[model samples]
Target: MQREDNFTFLTEEPIPKVIGTMAVPTIISMLISNLYNIVDTYFVGQIDTQATAAVGIVFSLMFFIQAFSFFFGNGSGNYISRQLGARNRESAEQMASTALGYTLIFSIVLVVLGLLFLDEISVILGSTPTILPYTRQYLGFSLLGTPFLMCTLCMNNQMRFQGYARYSMYGIIVGALLNCMLDPLFIFGLDMGIRGAAIATVIGQIVGFAVMFRMSLHKDIIHYTPRNFSHRWLFVKEIIAGGTPSISRQGLASIATIALNVSASQFGDAAIAAMSIVNRIVMFIFSVIIGLGQGYQPMCGFSYGARHYERVKAGFWFCVKVGTAFLLFWSVVLFAFSDRAIGLFRNDVDVISIGIPALRYQLLSFPFWSFMIMANMMMQTCRKTLQANILAASRQGLFFIPLILVLPHCFGLLGVEICQACSDFVSLLVTIPIVFSAFREMHV
Candidate 1:
């Protein structure tokens, strides 16, 4: 009875309500997090166009940081969630501790190296002549906080595995609110400009880290302590094996951003800012679906672990319906307000003109992109690693890279704007067979 009670994915209730209960808090958390990013961009934009470009360039670096964090965080969380579902607390503790410890150590190393190579890193991220100074000021302080940043992600994921999404949401909410408040105060009240915006971000993240760590320290089914961690090669190997797909996904995203920045430089600084704004806006709108997909992941993982194939099928279909509806609604919102939306980030007439059309094109892909994302999430949760990796690689990986290269040559800037949406449409078509096949053999 106790084991059954602990197993959320084993619930025999209708899948929609069960998935909704789990997904709503997660969606709220992601939406708030996305709002913080938008706020970061908005406040920074007030400084200057150079400052805005700096935000975009530095964001690519942050994605690289998140890639490492997600690798360990998701890998560990996936295993731990299943263990907890099966009522095995000890193994969960070990995995949780190992992930936390590695994140801290890795974050420190990344921060030290990032600080040391600050200038070169900034240049490689495609900082323009005018944008370089502001980029340094923002990226430099942010590096010092990298350890906290990485640990925060691990803690958040660990908590989510424990089915404590509300606590995770609280930490992120407080952090976002703090950041939003400080952005205006630091930038305008203190007259500190770009550096102030960076400071605000660091301070806000520190608050989030503090809150998440506190929530994580409770006497739960899974706990994180250095003593419980293992130095065994197999444990590390397993974690890496499970996490490699995520590393490829997020790492490739970071690389793709760098490539995009380098490519856009030929067009000019406005091009970088314009595309950056478009990406941020797309991310903001997509957060709800991504959150719902994340909510579905643990359900899929635990159900697969227990061989509860019917529940897995139910949850998978539930997620697809929810994701489709949410994305479709937001796509309309974005399309209707794209011009005003892009203007919030910049006042440049040229930037707005290019950005509005690009933002619309990017958003047009979301309704279908939701299907691709949910499909990939389902594959990962079920440990269908090869399928997961392929799906993960499709959007910005194999498809986008080729499309990005070829389309620009063929159609110029409009090609760049429309390529991702076109690629997403094609990716969804490719995903149909795989998704349905998984559903067809839903019984374990």
Candidate 2:
């Protein structure tokens, strides 16, 4: 709980410079992490459509785990950053360590529960009869590492909050690189097949956790100690209250993904794989926006806590502008080379044929989608839980479920592909009024 170098060092600098410097590292970090996921699909795709679909199912399962991690990590780290901004480093460290401890315990329980009901959970996550074995094989191993993944997220959030984004980026970069290198070795050399991917993922996360731990001890300004470890009800409640929206957002997406996979399964294994690949590619693109938004988050949280409303507004708009421009550019690139992108994971003619329209439709909506993402993140950082939850739920949870079901049933495969983008459009329309009211209220 000692005072160290403060992030207010950048407060006097230009907002654009501060954001760009911080956001770029975080974006690269996400890109590196996403590239590993793409590599996972690429290697597993060689095994067969079932294997690839298993990867997709596992990804959704991971998203469900991430929902809780984000809820706790963001909740705790948001307040920690604000406390640090207010020069209360002791409370900041306490919050950081407590959240990390809570996440580790939660992860252990999740792994047990996940493995205990592996078959049922696998089925619920959209595993078809053919894909169930592969899903179980991979998820079974990966579930064991859930604690590492969750703790890693908590550590990364704390590092980011402490303004040590560079170290965080290194941890992720090293882990991703290791995962990519190990994928082929485990998949082919060791003859582990789809389960090999799971092993590599866990190994990569361990390496990440190690690096983050070192960064926490060596580079972090606010350090955790066992002496000041007593739990406080108010702090825990505050963390939950602040982070509830993120939980709702990620939790809803988990539900929606399960729904998408289930509905996609009805069309056949090819449809499922096609939709899965489409999701991976689109998610990679979305991660860039998310990474940038994450960089803005600590700043927004800190500034808002300090009552620097103008800085919060400035940071929000900066993210919006950068996010919109990047999303627009990526959308065009994805659209222009949609065929090449779809063909990267699989050579299945049916998958490529079905995926092209789906990819194009989803990518086309990225520009408008930026507004929803920015708004949601802004609300979350400012601790506007209800508004943030509503915004978070809009596209995936609320609008998407009905759209995915009704559209596919009515219009068939094309409708399934178009449903998400259609939901995104509606969400954007709904967001405009909310945005106006939010900005108006921000002044007060």
Please tell me which predicted candidate would have the highest TM-score against the true structure.
2
Q: What's the lDDT of the predicted structure labeled candidate 1?
A: 0.79
* Alpha-carbon runs more than 4 Å astray in model 1: 1-4, 8-10
lDDT of each residue in 124-226, candidate 1, tens digit only: 9998887899999989987877777788877777777566666667777878789899999998999988888888888888998898878776654355677
Give the C-alpha miss distance for residue 390 in model 1, angstroms.
1.0
lDDT of each: 0.79, 0.83
Q: If scored against the real structure, what TM-score would every candidate get?
A: 0.95, 0.96
Strongest candidate by lDDT: 2
**Residue 223 CA displacement from its true place in model 1, Å:** 1.8
Residue 303, model 1, lDDT: 73
Task: Report the C-alpha lDDT of model 2 over 100-185, residue by residue, as the tens digit.
Answer: 87888889999889989999999999999999999999999898778877887777777776666777687788888999999999
